[model samples]
Target: MEGLALDTIIAKAGARPAAALACASTHLRAAVAEDAVWRSFCARDLGLDAPLDPEDRPLPSFKVGKRLREDRTLTNYMDAYKVWSESFGMYPLPLVKRVKLFWSSLKGWISENFPEALRTLSKGASEAQIRSAEDDLGFKLPMPTKLLYRFCNGQLPFSRNHFEDVRMAPLGIIGGYVFYDHSVNVHLSSLEQMVEETKEFNLDLEEQGLPIGPNLALVASSWYHPKTFILNCSSGDLYVGTANLSAGEMMPCVPKSLIKPTDSDMPQDGLLLWLEEHLRRLQNGMIKIRPLKTSRYICLYPEASPLCSSAVTNGVKVRASAVFAPEHPYGGHPGTYLYSYSIRLSVPEACMLGGVYFSSCQLHSRHWIIRCKDTVVSDVNGEGVIGKFPLLLPGQDEFVYESCTPLNGSSGSVEGSFTFVPGRVTQPEGKPFNVTVAPFPLQVPDYIF
Candidate 1:
């Protein structure tokens, strides 16, 4: 054993037996419990330093050290370690303390950085109002939710052009799904309206194979898509629901069908935790920002160069570029200029680019016709760039495709997005999201700005 490598001897003895023997031995206890032996064991098994007192008065005992090492060997523990390592800064405090800290930090940040963007429909909700809303809904609001209402009755509408936008509901209308209440109406939904809407949405969800728990309430909704964010009042878990736009009209005469619920990858501690993480990311520049007002097509992901733009979301990068072929107009039709567009997509993580969609303002307005070879590929109102959709493979980090759009006008533009599907077998119902396509100019070389 002395001549053999430590790992070789350990392998011969086996992990369990060696650990048990080390714990039980009294004669060789001094040698087995040596600082160097425990340090090596800790490093090898747990990828951590052995525990020791500040003054080094008492080293970790064999049982304690072995227990820690053994715990790391468990699959669940390893997974937890990976999450903790990745999210340490994102969630540094426990849920109870974190919620308070988050609200305070958010208030200060908004006041300092976005004071004009902050508008309240009313002062904080009174206890009476909270009780009435809860009683009407048949569920008590979570404490974090209550605390948030105390800060602001509602928030002003700020454009969230990117997929990673963080939007929270005003306390007055926590259960409302419409974005216009914040943007156009500048008012929060009353407690009575919230109850009515939640019940109605829940009924619709039941028909969609995702019946909302009585204790769960809608917290926020995305402006960019038909997705609703929800939180369980009792469990404090967050969930997302995407509308099945293809499911036809929500008419009573229509037959009911299954509509999937998309789960957010955020922690389950509650809305407070989710908001805190997002705000922290924004403060630290981890999140990208697109201006609320812009003349250019909303660049969801800004580009480093004017010719190309890229944006990364959920571990996928979507890049776009364009080339003009003014001399080669489609169908030999004069005034119809040809533009070549390219999408360079990369999915380095465990996700796939399920589909790509391209639409232009000019195209939507019936000003452009797109063609492939000699054939007319798209009418002005076509669904996407190419008539057919293609899937990006799991390990496929790079994909390039070119398409030509023929504009009837001398100058116009084209822009759209890519859809990403997560690569988890267990995530069958996961919803896809759009990675925005930066707008590219299509102009005749002689056309002046």
Candidate 2:
């Protein structure tokens, strides 16, 4: 029995029958043992193209697939995969694959970096649960978002009262940044939470005499932080709550063009695109997990170059980056957009400027030229940043400070220089010289958290 002959027999008789035949005949067993034969069985039976586990790690042999059927634990995993794939069958195969990949990647990252947070992930929501949420919200969710929930229902439940407690609040999957007292860690809402939050928001709007729409749902948010993401089921757009949320104002999270339906016969939405792009950024190292006081969250601030600016002047190294702070309504100013920026300055080695060798530098004052597109908006001249003079000495840790700026427009750039004295502010070693703060964009991102 040749391999091709065995494949033909297996295709006709199926795996169980073929296995029985292999047990009876040595030649047939030899042919059935071929990797290709079991590989075909894996695809036909398990819908797996490669000999790999759920985490995408390789399996020893394709024939190990038979165990997945008999083992109860593995059976549950396979059943979930089948159910999820079947649920989104109307979508393009590539898209279904992409969605699975995103969850797998996210889980892998969380397991390695923050395993405790991994426990927070709930199992996939059932069809009945999803339908219940849809009925409660009085609208159907988009196909992409439906498929998303089918993979994982969202994070675990938490009491509203304990959401702000540092010891109790679970680390959010969509990590946030910290600058002083402000904190934001965003998490996806489960089907139950979605209905509740949406209803609560609608009630608030009604109390304020604002119109309530049936198509809206609260999909994600940062507890104790003002940031909230709302989904418009009819339009397939996801929006971030603006300062005027009570007045029914919002900003689109995904570009309109990117949220259209694909050839998969399924409509793509902002939630799906936003998450995929976010995953891409995480996997590519554009952003990273950051530690807070007693916990950690995913920091939105871009750490890579271009998005993050770095420059060295007279041996004074400065690095700066910024993140959109939608939660910060900026003193109730509806038109203004808020962004938090972090600036780090260090003097790792001694420097010489204008024939003066100095071992250290002390921040004196600062100048910032803020622009929106080509037009200058604010030229700020201030004393010490955040009111403290940072002394930079060789081999010492970098002096870091985070401050925010408001933008009237959606896009802008910040570029300026810092005046530094060669020694401590109390005792100057040389005349003050300028250190550059390289230009970095303060523009809105396509994927809003």
Candidate 3:
């Protein structure tokens, strides 16, 4: 037994069938999932491998089926490899194309949502000034992403949705153009910085005299910065979406959907397919659904969903959520006081809290959306800026439109039930909904940088 051959040891292990196979030849054991084993370094890798020396490369394809195939050791193990990407969140993620488009739209979405980043960059953007930023971040900027940044920085014609139309239009000016003020500060700086730094770095490329743009555009991320999201423009399709963050989570998330897991429902690999389908169904138009049979469902808002009901995708099913307040439909907070309008949201159940942020504390037993806002009691009236409004749409059925209250962060923090109403829904018996509520709603927060 001490001098036994490898296969002989395997035979003995089969005969003994003991618990100590850990000490035995673990490698000789039959593959639990043979296809998965092959998939780790399959045909795709062979055809399109990164530039590696002939000596460093793996064996190319051999005939199958009729061949008496000899077993070969796996160079890369897929199961064990997954842990490296754990920081990116859950796995078997959405299509790469979607992720790219998401990043592109993300550049735009963040531009749309957070104009502060654009405004700060726009106030003083010059060719050299942007170059310094590129040195800081370490990547080349593409013409399009740059243009969008300029648009955010108030350099071009773009819509600034953050403030009231009357006020924001004047404030969001760039290059003597009104729409240019719609730029985002962070994105503009990042773009300007990328373009400037790369120009010098690619001096070698100029020496080689090969077309230069591909070097800047071909790679998905910057060498200096954490890879920014790149939109998949293969199909000219784009997604409009937002990123949610937690104390410790990773990106290009593998988890099909984000949820506050409960005692009953838990997260698992099976959920990936569900997420993929949900993204596909909402590539265009809005969708609203309430399930009578299932206690839980997913809400997919892939940035392509429409703003109005007529375009809502009828076949798609998603989770319900609430809204954030500030830029209310009718404008300033004062006018919408004590008033209510149905909120249009990705998942309808979101409501105003933290005054400025949206909180989903009512769902799945944890706080979903929340923000920190300043509060001051008014001498003019008992009215202080109560500071939050949960948005609703008219068709939603699970909850009711109730009075708003300021939370001190304690509901015993259990998953509680509530009713939902459409943004268009009205309470004939109570104060008119339209007169009261106008409300509204990132990814690795830029602070991580």
Candidate 4:
């Protein structure tokens, strides 16, 4: 037969049959070993555009080099890739590819901006490790979650043993917000970490005489903060622990409808979906990285327009936004909701208020009108903010401060104005005037980041 005819025949016969036929004759072996023939087979079977393994290593031949799934080299680190790739064989190819794309996108962003944080990501865990966790926890992990770890194990927990270590704490991929003494930065837990935390969580519940469900597993938590995320391994839903968690109450992080698979034959889980949605927000600039203290971390607060409100009055501009802090849910008050708002004030140019040119301004006081629905809840006047009066300089960096409040209901709005003098608070250059702080919405997000 012609070479083209022979290559086509071997391709259709599949890898095993072609390998067997290749041994029959030298010509048959040459045709079967052709790179073009094997490449087509690899693409058909594995959805691969290039000949690479799970670790992204180049393969020798598509016929014998069937990625890490069948390559099976038994090293401590490579074993995890083998097991993960094998487990992924059962899922639909499209879903498997999508799961990879999600992690890749997030990792790409981290590598570009926070390369040190990206280096902290652990290698995939072995099947034995995952099984050990399941044995210890007494529950099987959801398939989607299993694949998630298979791509990359959870981030390594930072050691905040010294003052300098405090800088690394905010490197968590699932970052959080800060309000006063309350600080949170959430990161995914490794299988080993999950086993230990779940055990400890159940123990605490047992001590308090609270019911401990066999299906609940602590999968993610803040590095040093009290916040934690729990996964129901059986049902595949994810939740964040609230301030009332010791009393056995938590809030769902993902929407219920999203947890359900579009096809009944295929199974879905919340942790996977949650991370995918988070990546979407990051790429869309809904939530972004912001500086906190001395380090920069992913801030859950919205940065774009609408969700964040901005206005200018008297040549002084104020931009403000709020984020729902689920970890501090209700602040021990079951009926209340907690929100953290960040206010940034700046004078982009020289202040030209009241036809008088001024070089700077100092904040004197603040007036806030908080509302739940349409009813006014709290009207207050206070001196300075967080006990500091920030001075705004012409063409200088904005002065930013974050504070929180507890609302009586789910939905509310905060509108306020700040009193500022044209110069130092001690030496006034002009009469104090109000700077507009536009109203911003406060509501529980449908999809919690």
Per-candidate Cα lDDT values, in order, are 0.43, 0.78, 0.26, 0.79
Candidate 3 runs further than 4 Å off: 1-36, 40-193, 196-449
Could you tell me the lDDT of residue 377 within candidate 4? 94
Q: Identify the superior model by lDDT, candidate 1 or candidate 3.
A: 1
Model 3 lDDT, residue 299, Cα: 24
lDDT tens readout by residue for model 1, 37-92: 54455344333343422112344342232334555662212222222223332322
Candidate 4 per-residue lDDT over residues 24-46, each given as its tens digit: 99988778766787677656655
Residue ranges of candidate 4 with Cα displaced over 4 Å: 1-49, 61-87, 158-167, 261-266, 354-357
The clash count for each model shown is 1, 2, 78, 0
Can you give the lDDT of residue 282 in candidate 3? 31
TM-scores vs. true structure, each candidate? 0.35, 0.80, 0.21, 0.84
Task: Estimate the lDDT of model 2.
Answer: 0.78
Name the TM-score of candidate 1: 0.35
Better lDDT candidate (2, 4): 4
Model 2 CA deviation exceeding 4 Å by range = 1-93, 160-164, 168-170, 179-181, 261-267, 331-335, 348-359, 395-397
Give the range of the ten consecutive residues with the poorest summed lDDT in model 3: 173-182
lDDT by residue (tens digit), candidate 3, 288-350: 222212211122211221221111121111222222111112212222311111222233433
Against the true structure, whose TM-score is highest?
Answer: 4
Give the TM-score comparing model 4 with the true structure, all chains together: 0.84
